[model samples]
Target: MLGSLLIANRGEIARRIIRTCRRLGIRTVAVYSEADAQAPFVREADQAVAIGPAPASESYLVGAKILEAALQSGAQAIHPGYGFLSENADFAEAVTAAGLIWVGPPPSSIRAMGLKDAAKKLMAEAGVPVTPGYMGDDQSEATLLAEAERIGFPVLIKAVAGGGGKGMRKVDAAKDFAAALTSCRREAKASFGDDHVLLETYATRPRHIEVQVFADSHGNAVHLYERDCSLQRRHQKVIEEAPAPGMTDEVREAVCQAAVRAALAVGYVGAGTIEFIADTTDGLKADRIWFMEMNTRLQVEHPVTEAITSQDLVEWQLRVASGEPLPLTQAEIPRRGHAIEARLYAENPHTGFLPSIGRLDHFRTPSDIRLDSAVEEGGVVTPFYDPMISKLIVHGPTRQAAAAKLAAACRAVEVYPVKTNAGFLARCLADPDFLSGAVDTGFIGERLASLLPPAEPSERVLQAAANEMVRRAGVPPALTGFRVNADPSFRVPLDHEGTRYTAQISPGAQPSALHVVVSGRDFIVFEDGEPYVLTLPRVEAGPEGSDGDGGVESSMPGLIIEVMVAVGDTVSKGAPLLVLEAMKMEHTLTAPFDGVVASLSVKKGDRVAEHVLLVKLDPSEVK
Candidate 1:
């Protein structure tokens, strides 16, 4: 085993690698950007080094600076955790050439699998079944359109480099193919710097299954079964689980053998993933599986693999890099239990899945399972990098237990200020269709409304909505001793999930009962220390507050992302003037009525507290 290793990444992945390193008695050196100076990973490492500035280009992606850190720290090897220079072939070569172990795959293998177009061609040549599409060198627009027409409609245009659904678009018709290609190319170039793309026949009801392959320098390789990451949004994985539900033994063996073959073909070393698109419409079969691109580095969902196999893949990587042969055979790796991982992102889920940013006033995730995250309660979710706040991972003896635990865990997680997809993940977990494992890439948008929380309030919410008035200029609990002689009721306007709630609070609106609403619905968060929240139908925001602020701002607590108009600019009735991306959805700040924008108090990218002044529109200047 290597004595010391420098981790060339930040956040949860870097911290994850450090954990395994410590278990194996490896001294670890952590490198961080300015933004991650006080990160958990830095504090956990044996030694920490400052690489560069905050931007990834200046920090994480700068291979030279990372290599310099390793050298200056006197580390024996470098571990490129998942992102950044993990897939950079040149970086691997430089690491070894600089007389340091790369602690990943051979540089040649990274080069072979770096580009999607190139990898697809190689996989096809290696007898691995590849998806039928245009993988040729023709970059001409007309040629791509012709290829799409040949492949039939509903083809996917994907970036040749990088994943994360960034530069991939599905074109259902020729009319949209060109535009999709242009947009994909721009995003690809901006994200991965490779505008080269490949087209594939988009399989209906496709399940993404990947094989974890490990190889050592001594020409030894083995397969670690498969993981199903079929439930996805924006082509990115949402929930991933091991021991795919209803997998046939014949197909499993074939996929594993094919993965081993693919690894051997590239002379792969260390841990790498061979992803395949499974057409479950005709049941799981070896013939129905098509090769997707191979990830050249450690995967984000590798923890699921570890939980099931009881093997530390990072330790294996270090051992392999040290010229150690395979410690165990293919049969040695055991699949013990089911593991599921949900990527918790700072995003809005209502209007559209837009990224959210801001300071996390309070973040409390479940302590029951393994959670991989770089952020804390006070961490800032910057727009400069990926908006993933954390990853909620759970494992159990059975798939049902795993799914149920994940659902319960999501509901219990409370992340304040910056919103997260905790509710969405819970809904996805509880979806009868999802629990049945009938999921694909378009699971979110296809069943958006059904999976989303209903836009209605519950009675318990009305009873506890007395505090909503206090938050918006109502009488405080300490001074609200005087009560009306009649019914003693007052309306507290509560807005959540784009709808308003008029809570009839007794004692003429006491300060204790605040409303927690979501999507035009109100829920009583049994602050009585209860587990579940009681919901109710929403009422209109009546004339309750002293201020003339008529606009229903943020219904729930979240961060505002984009302010679209200046003061006195808007004139339309419902034109979106500002965008509030909360919990992975975009809620537009629109005109309350047909009027002109009057008083705007917030700017773009400003983190506004819930119910803060977003935009005040004059309800008069209408026709």
Candidate 2:
């Protein structure tokens, strides 16, 4: 085994590789950009090197700088964790030429599957079921339009290179095909440097199920069942599970075998994935699953596979890269219980799930299950990289148990300041269709209403607060002596979500009775309502930092992509104030609201940070 290795990537996956390297007695060298100097992944490595600026093109994607770092560190091997140049064929070849082991599939295999259109054609030749679509090389608009019409009405235009829902578009009718193709081609060219696209018939109800396959230099490969990545938003997976929820025994076997065949087709070695789109309406079948794509590196949801198989995939990658024979036969890989994973991101769900950045004031993770992360409480969630905070994974003997555990684990964990998708994830796991195992790729949008719990308080909660506050502070209590007076009325103050809720207190019951109503909720005062409601929402902590987490001024740095407000706009709390597009993702700024703009510091197309003043407002208007 190699004693030292260089990780040519950043973020959580890079940290994950370092962890496995440590366990295997391999020293790790981490490469980071200028903005990532203080990143958690950079600090966790045995040795670190500065590559370039914050932009990935000048930093992580700089193959020459990466090679220089590896050679300088005297590393014997390089591991490209999942993204950036992980699937770059030339990078793999360059590492080998430098006398360093490339801890991934061979360069030849990456070349074969790098392009979606070509890969589909190859799969068809290998007898692996592929989606019926146009895999031809003709890029003329006329030819493409003709193919789309012949294939069907609804189709998908996917980039030949790149993944992660980037450079992909869905066309529902011929009328929209031309515009979608243009947009898709532009994004593809920008994201992957290749505008080549392939059209595929859109599945009526698509379920993204992929099989994990491991192979060794000795040409031995085995399959590791499959994972269901059906639940997603904006083409990004939100939840994933192993031993797909509604798969049958026969179909599972056929799908697994097909994946094994696809892997072996290219003499594939190390950990790889063969993604398939399944039609569950008629149940699983050998003919029901179609080859979608292949991920040429360790997947983000690998922990789910590890939980079920009790095997370390990272170790397997190292072993395979060492030219060793398969460690275990196909029979040795057992299908155990169910496992599920949810990606927790530092983003907001209230407004189109825009990425949010801030200090993790109270970062807490659950210990009942496995958790993989690279950030900590004091770590800055900079817009220089992916906003994903961590991945929460859980295992249980049954699917129901796994769902239950995932829901509880998500809710039990707490993160302050930067809003996260944890609440959204918890709601998804507890969803009825998900629990019943009747899910599909369109689940998130199909059931958006019931799944999203309205951000409104219950009447009982308001009543309880009013009763408690009035009894606790007698300064604003009803003037009528409770025991002696027949009737009485009083007004009291309450606060909620940065808004004030004035309560009206009414005397009821025989003697010495108290009843209060706030926001149409009734509350009865017991023991003068002292203990129940200390202060009704307590809104007037004016001009003070009331952020739930430790008040950090700026969480990340990015360009002010757009500014929606100027001084003097009476916006509500939670309204979009502006947007910061960084790291290929958009982070939105929200108004503290109920205040007029006092000043403006930054405008659209300017650079800003967590502490930077884009806009200022008066705190008094909030009252």
Candidate 3:
């Protein structure tokens, strides 16, 4: 076994690797950027080193810095925990050249499967069924447009080097193809530094299924099982589960065998995942499944595979890198009950999933399940990294039981100041179609409104907040009016999201288990994983405070990537004004109402902080 290891990534994944290392008696060294200096993973490691500034380009993505950290800390192996440089073949080679073990697939495997277009061609050559698409070398716009037409109207434009739903777009009509292609290319260039893309036919009822395969230097490979990651938003996975709900024995064999073949074809070692796009319109048949791409490193959803197989994948990676043989044969690997994982992100579901950054103030998750978290109660969620704060994994005897347990766990999540998608996740698990195993990639988009929590606090939630407020004010719950004939309740004025409500606090009223947290003059009431931040109404504020002043402010700290409108531009409601890249995602700010752009303060490439006014709009006079 490797004596010591260096983790080259941050957040929950770093903590996850450290956990298995600790169990195996391996000393762990953590390399962090300035932004993550005080992160939970840094404090949990056996040793730590600061690499560079907060920007990933200057820190985590810099191979030389990471190599130096490992050398300085005397780490025998470097574990690229999934994201930054995990799949960078050059980085892997650099690590090996420095006489340090790279705890991942061989550099050759990464390079072979790094680009989607090339990987698909390679998979097809290896006799593995691949999705029908154009992976040709024609780079001109005319060729791409012609290819899209030939592939059919509904086609997917995917970046050759894309993953995690970035640099991908689906166009349904020929008229919208050009604009979509331009946007896709721009994003692809910004994300992967490569604007090359491939066209693929978009499945009407697509299901994302991936097989978890592991290999060793002894030329042995085996698959743990498969995971269904169909519950997605913006092409990114929202929930994942092991042993897909409708997978059959025969189909499982076919897919799993194909995955192993793909691994062996590239001489892959260590852990990797072969992602497939399945046409579920005809069920999970063998012929309907097609290879999409290969992830040459550990995946974010690997825990579900670990739970179902009763295997420590990180341990397996470590062993393989240490020149060990496969621990179990294909048939020897145990497969058990179902498991589900929900990614808890620090974002507001009410605001179209905008990333929310702030101090955690109060962070509490259920204790019974396995939780891999990045931030704790007092930790801050900076905008420099991914918004995912934790992942909640639950295992049960059956799929239904597992989904139920996961849903309950999501509802049990209690966070404050910073918003999260816990409530949205719980609702997704409880959705009738989801529970019935009828989900597709478009499930969330089809039922988004119903899945979101209520925009306003319910009557019960308001009452609970009022009760907590009264209790905190040192007033007894059973207190009655001083007048003989006076009513037994007093009105408490509360403001929630700029709306005022007068809650009649009845004396002796029983308080509900709404999980209320008191913060100064505000009471944050959590119900079903949705937080309702309520504050005591200010006596001097007026109704106008709720109205918008036509000033467009940055919701979070980010770099301006594009400005679509000028100062004199007349735009209607929902017209895109500019694009802000933050937290590894691009957000387009749109006009809130029909207005004329009166002022423009920021330009492309300008880095702005949260709440900085970027544009000012005036109501259109002609309207």
Q: Name the top TM-score candidate.
A: 3
Taking all chains together, the TM-score of candidate 3 against the true structure is 0.85
lDDT, candidate 1, 1-623, per-residue tens = 78999998888888888888888899999988888887788899999999888999888988889888899999999988887888888888999999998889887898899888888889988999999999889899999999999999889999999687789888999999889999999999998888999999988778899999999988899988899998887678888988888888888999989999999999998999999998777778789899998998889889899889988888888889888998799877788989999988888765576888888766777798889887888778888677777888888999889999999888777765566678888889988988887777677769878765444645565555435423433244333222334333434444545565556555433444432433223333422112223333221122321135545454433346776777767466556676765433455655555677777776766654334455667777554
User: What would you estimate as the lDDT of candidate 1?
Assistant: 0.77
Residues 1-623 of candidate 3 have per-residue lDDT tens digits of 99999999999999999999999999999999999989989999999999999999899999999999999999999999888999999999999999999999888999999999999999998989998889999978899889989999799999998888889999999999899999999999998899999999998999999999999999899999999999999988899999899999999999999999999899999999999999988888999899999999999999999998899999999999999998889889988999999999999998999999999999999999999999889999998888999999999999999999999999999998899999999999998889899989999999999999899999888998888766765554333443356576666667898988868777678877788888767789999998898887532101211137567876434578999999888888777888876433466777777888899999999876545678878885425
> Cα lDDT of all candidates, in order?
0.77, 0.78, 0.88
Off by over 4 Å in 3: 476-479, 539-623
Instruction: Quote the positional error of residue 414 for candidate 2 in Å.
Output: 1.7
Off by over 4 Å in 2: 458-494, 502-623
Q: After superposition, how far is residue 429 of candidate 2 from its true place, in Å?
A: 0.5
Task: Sort the candidates on TM-score, descending order.
Answer: 3, 1, 2
